[model samples]
Target: MSQFWSELVHNLDPYVPGEQPKVNNLIKLNTNENPYPPADSVLEAIRNATDDKLKLYPDPNADLLKQRIADYFSVQRNQVFVGNGSDEVLAHAFQALLKKDKPLLFPDITYSFYPVYCGLYGIDFQTIPLDEDFAINVNDYGDQGGAIIFPNPNAPTGRLLTLKEIEKLLINNQDKVVVVDEAYIDFGGQSAISLVNQYHNLLVIQTLSKSRSLAGLRVGYAIGHADLIDGLERVKNSFNSYPMDRLAIYGAVASFDNEEAFQQSCRAIINTRETLTDKLQSLGFKVIPSTANFVFASHPDFSAEQIAQKLREKAIIVRYFNKPRINEFLRITIGNNDENAALCTALSEIITS
Candidate 1:
């Protein structure tokens, strides 16, 4: 630790993102990215955005992009907030909405970013553990806290809580904000943004990276009551005036315009996820029912670490968390058909031999 570093930095346990390997021809299923490409319209729009206009600074408020998102979600302009990515949007929320005198509350096994955000902002937080089935129990969240946030179809586990359960949490805690990270809602679950109009305390954040296949562009947005959006905007303006660039804004707008194409891509991934789950189960792995673009599975005969190493030897990569209660499970993203076939083939040989 350097003497120049602040005490906060010394105590922080930074979030380690999934590795992005540089090897060629490797079947990468570690990160939950869409196997499909972005819509043609989105590509055309992005290409068009790469013009002399880029020399000019983008709209600091990102008004046009916000309007497009508002139109798509049927929310008002003031009710929508855009950021560099959902991660940044979530970071802003942790500081603006979750830093209270009381501790923030979230699932123990939820997004690793949540805890990292808490550490970054010096927010006191408490974790609510998921049930034995690896599903979120809404009833367990009846405690005093500053705010609450969790992925709907939670990460790694891919188990989802119903929209009614989310609304129940909002209803029970009317005074506090509840942020739902819907990055994977397009896969197998419904979005909680539908309830944002009814619940003033609800904030639903989504990313174009996963579902819309624009991870490289880095665009994400949040929908909520106008007041909550205003609070986030206040924090955002204080930090950076132009988090969304011109290309990102135009690309995000085009993504919303081609909603049908993106929906089709999501459907295909869901189908692949079903097939992948069945294949893993046939190989004696207990696969969780996934609503996200990935599957979480644990083998009866082999440990998660062993399987990950074997897959790596075959030029395939999947995520393995060396943590408790889930140390035996691997979070494998659903790749394209050929990629999935290769992964299954590699696993079959490893298991058989």
Candidate 2:
């Protein structure tokens, strides 16, 4: 290690995002990105924003974007906070709301970024194991943390918890913060944003990168009580007031305004997800019940890594983790109709051969 590096840097383990391969015309499905393009109105809004406005910094407050989000979620602008992406918002959250005397709590198998944030901010955290079925049983949490956070439709497994279950944790853990990272919530699950007004301790974070098909733009936000929002604001202002660029603010606002297109795309992904699940099951793969835009499955006879390698040889990519309970499973993103068909065909050959 370099002597110039800080102690934190020397010990930090960064989160590994899935590869964005440069190969052309590949059936890319490793990362959970929307296979559909953004609405035409979103493009128009970004194009319209390419005027003399580029000469100056965007409103550091991101007033119009915040207002759009607040109106859409039925919250006040003061109760909302926007950042370059949900990852940035989550980092600020770890530093502000989660760093308490008690250790933060999350699923042992989750977004994979939660623990990284804890390490980055020096936040104490403990991992509660998912139940035998790879599902989070909210009752097990039992009010033992400074804060709680997890993806609703959790990553890798794509399992979701009901609003009733979420409310149970929030009610029991009212003394501390509860952050719900809803980056994939728009696909088929209900949002915890509906309960933000009821729970002052709850902060629901969302991103346009997945559901709105705008990963390149990097826009994400959180809805919470004004006090919690203030904590994020303190951290954000301490670092950089202009976390969101002019284009991101404009484009994300347009994404919120184009509700019909966003919903339609989500519907498309959900439909394809169901179809893909059935196709996998028919081939003897035990696919988990998924409410997100991805499916996690594995065949009883074949290994996850073996299938992943076979798929890769055919120019298809899917996620295979060599971690604990999930090592046998493959996490496949639901792509467009053609892409799904290609994946199905590839799996058929791989399984039959």
Candidate 3:
């Protein structure tokens, strides 16, 4: 390590995202990204925005996108805060709301970025372990943390925590902020935006990357009480004045108008997820019940790392974690019909050979 680095930089353990290989024609299902293209209208919106507007700075507040998101979620404009992506929005959140007197709490196996954010912000934190089935046990939180945050239908495991459980947690910890990361909530899970008004402490974050098929656009937003939104806005404005660009703002706004494409893509991914789960189970895999657009499975005979390596050799990639309790499982994103079939065929060949 370089001596020029600051103390915080030296101690940092950054989050490692999934690999983005340039290998062509490979079946890539490692990252949980939508395989479908966004609505043609969204593309057209971006094209229309490509004029001389690039020379000028975008709306610092991203008011138009916020208005559309607010209308979609039935929340007021004052309750919405837009960011570069959910990652940035989450970063601002950890600094604004989560760093309180007590330590923050989150599911141990949930999103990996939570801990990285805590470290970056110098916030004290604690992890509550998921149950044996990899499901979040809300009772374990027990009003201990200064704030709470977790993916609704959790990542890597593809398990969901019911809204009732979320409400219970909110009721128990009424004084603290509760952030629900709903990046994959549109697949088979309902969004917590509906309950945001009921719990003033609740903040629901969503992205256009997954459901709206705009991963490249890098736009995400949060819906919550106006007071909570104000706190996040304060942090955001302090860091960057123009988080959302002109193209992203227009494209994300148009994405909200494409209801048919959004619904169709969500349904297709959900269907493929179920089919992939059944196919894996037929091949002696233990597939967890998934509400998200991915399946988490493990085989009794083969280890997760072995399976992952074998798939990579065959140009098929799926996510595998080396951490405790989940090291044996592979988190496979649901691809298109042809890609899914190819993965299944490859697995069958690997299992037999």
lDDT of each: 0.92, 0.93, 0.92
Query: What's model 3's overall lDDT?
Result: 0.92
Per-prediction TM-score to the true structure, in the order listed? 0.98, 0.99, 0.99
lDDT, candidate 2, 19-84, per-residue tens: 999879889999999999999999999999999989999899999999999999999999999998
Error of 1 at 268 (Å): 0.5
lDDT of 3 by residue, 1-353 (tens): 99899999988999999999987988889988898999999999999999997999998999999999999888899999999889999999999999999999999998899999999999999999989899998889866789999998998888998889989989998998999999999988878898999999999999888888888899989999999999999999899999999999999999999899999999999988888988999999999899988899999999889999999998999999999889999999999988999999999998999
Candidate 1, lDDT over the whole model: 0.92
Which pairs clash in model 1?
none
- Sliding window of 10 residues with minimal summed lDDT for model 2: 138-147
lDDT ranking of the models: 2, 3, 1
Q: In candidate 3, how many Å is residue 233 off? A: 0.5
How much is the lDDT of residue 256 in candidate 3? 93
Candidate 1 local lDDT, 141-178, one digit each (tens): 76678788889899989998899999899899898888
Which residue pairs collide, candidate 2? none
